[model samples]
Target: MHPLVRWFHQLGSPPYFDRFAARWAPWCHGIGAVTMAVALWLALFRIPADYQQGDAFRILYVHVPMAWMSMAVYLGMAIYAAIALVWRIKLAEILAMACAPIGALYTAVTLATGSIWGKPMWGTWWDWDPRLTTELLLLFLYLGVIGLYAAIEDRRQAARAAGFLAVVGVVLLPIIKFSVTWWNSLHQGSTISLTGPSHMDASMQLPLWLMVIGTHVWFVGALLARARADNLRREAGKAWIAETA
Candidate 1:
């Protein structure tokens, strides 16, 4: 078998995963912190103000990354949920459930920052724009998954039920992504594109990309930490738990 496949198989073991998470989570967190700090420094002091919005545009450095994370994390959660549902992988269930709160957090930040940014740009704190509305629905879906997981008495069953909801909610992602294009919305169109040149200047774009990369790495650390804790709780009284302790 391939080394990668073997490593993945080993990762499936609760004790092995616990050790792996413990060893790597801190490193990921440290890297995320350093990257975010550099990004913030560049965004605050080094980059030029927007020609139109001025310093207010700096919020995009935070807002855009969180907005991206909100959708990206949900997509990841849904994939983990699908795997858990089909394969009954306990680690997948833990990961899917762990992702809910983090995704919800990113969604909340996106909305809050968007509101702050919008007030100056659109002259309103909130609007039922297509992008905003679908994003709100996405938040609700995240909360619903979290609530459902907590409502059931049995942990595995709760995970499965919540995972099912997560899988069903995958439809929201595309709608959120294309909302501005599909409707006459106040929100702006995409500025950055992987396949083409970005609309923003290179200097302004650099920090935003740094923040995006930092946040994703931070997310992995957070996810692994949360999953490790949940795994320990679920495995209470097991031989490995005792051994680990």
Candidate 2:
């Protein structure tokens, strides 16, 4: 096996993660910052607004990516929860715990931007649309995990509870994914489709993809840094952790 594989396995042990984070966090920060800058330039200025929607369509850059990330992050949390539950890995639990708040923030951004765009396009800000409603519920699920984690004092106990919450939350995700298709809604159908045909042009499509890549990278940076901090706090008294510090 590769030395990096060995390093990753040791990461579940905490001390190695701290050392890894100490060396790599700065790089992650730097890259994410640069990526954000490039994404802003591409999304805000280089990419022209829609022909029909005009300035209103600009919201899609933020809205679409956040909506996608919110769901993607939740799915990730569920996977981490499963890993923690099955393997009894502290690192996985902490990673799942760290993912919830960020995921919630992304969900909020999705809803808020969707609302902002809706006012101009649909002539209304709020809707009982299945897609919109299901996404809102996703935000609530994120908050539930965060709150449940904080409610308990013991880290192990808290993680187990949060992990369980995340696992249960997984069932709601398919509902979010299919909500637009399954029910009537003021919201338009998906811009990008799995089978074929993205309802967007190259001018619009390029920046949106850039934003997606940038955010996924942001997710990695955030998850790793937060997971590293978590390991530090949990492994506070260990000889290796101390030596690593």
Candidate 3:
């Protein structure tokens, strides 16, 4: 086999992954902390207010990143779930299950911050905008996965059932992402794109990028922490677990 495939196999080993998670979780957290703090400072203090939206626009620093992560995490969870179902990788199952609560948290944050921003910008606390409605549905999907997993008695069986739900829910992700384009909506078009010029000025853009990157780094740290706990619970009968304990 190729060296890359060998490396992947090695990384998939539970014990190896546990050690890797232990070693890197703290580093990711540390980096996430520093970046988020710097990003907040830049967003709140340095970036000028939008001439049109004024100070209300600063909320984008929080809302956009959380919204982006909500979708990204769901996609990631579905991929992990697929791997668990197809390859029967225990780590994939753990990771997929772990993703539920975190994704839900991001979804909740997105909704809350979006609402807060909306009241000022749109003069209403809520609107059934296409993007907002789909985002709310995304939250329900996350919660459904969590509820289904908790309702099952056996961990492995629960993961399988929840994985199926997660895979099915992947359909919601595209709907959430494309709602702005597919329908008339209060939500503005995306401000940043990798393939196109950003609508934001450089000052505002840098901090938003920093926050986005930091949010992802923080998410990995959170996932590793949750996955580690899951590893312990699932592997309680294994000798390596006792040794690590």
Candidate 4:
């Protein structure tokens, strides 16, 4: 087998995964922390206030990253769910289930920060804008998966059920992405673009990118840590757990 394939197969083992997560999770957390700290400092102190929104625009650094992660994590969870359902990969199931709480957290943060940013700009803390509404739906989907997973006594069965919900919830992602364009939204359109020129000045864009990168890295660490704990619980009383303990 190819080295990469071999490594992947080895990673499917609960014990091996436990060791791998333990070894890597801390590094991811540390890197994410340092990067986010620098990003926050630059966003808060170094970057000049927006000509239009003034200092209130600084919240975008926090809001945008979490908003991006909320969707990204959901997509990731759905993919993992599909893999687990098709192949019955226990690790994939664990990973899919593990993603729920983290995704929900990011989604909640997105909503909260968006509300905070909106209070000054839109003169309201809440709105029924298409973008905001769909994002709120995404949070509910996450909670549904988490709640469904916990409701069942059988871990594997619960994962499969919740995983199915996650898979089905993917339809909401694009709607959320395109809501501003598709509807007359109170929220602003996306300013940053991957392929095209961004609308914001380069100086302001720098910390936003840093925050995005940091949050993604931090999410991986959090996912692995959560999955590791779930893996241990599922594997309790097994020979590997005994030896590892």
lDDT of 3 by residue, 127-210 (tens): 999999999999999999999999998999999999999999999888888899999999999988889888887766989989
Error of 4 at 140 (Å): 0.3
Q: Tell me the TM-score of each prediction against the true structure.
A: 0.98, 0.93, 0.97, 0.99
Residue 27, candidate 1: alpha-carbon lDDT: 89
Name the candidate, 2 or 3, with the larger TM-score value: 3
Ranking by TM-score: 4, 1, 3, 2
Candidate with more favorable, higher lDDT: 1 or 4: 4
Model 3 stretches astray by more than 4 angstroms: none
Clashes of 3: 0
In terms of lDDT, which candidate is strongest?
4
Model 1 scores a C-alpha lDDT of: 0.95
Worst 10 residues of 1 by lDDT: 195-204
Sorted on lDDT, best first, the list reads 4, 1, 3, 2
Model 2: residues with Cα > 4 Å off, grouped in runs? 1-5
Candidate 1 per-residue lDDT, tens place, 1-245, comes to: 99999999999999999999999989889999899999999999999889999999999999999999999999999999999999999999999999999999999999999999999999999999999999999999999999999999899999999999999999999999999999999999988888887889876788999999999999999999999999999999999888868
Better of 3 and 4 by lDDT: 4
Question: How much RMSD separates candidate 1 from the native structure?
Answer: 0.8
Ten-residue region with minimum lDDT total, candidate 4: 195-204
Model 4 misplaced regions, further than 4 Å: none
lDDT of 3 at 144: 95
Candidate 1 runs further than 4 Å off? none
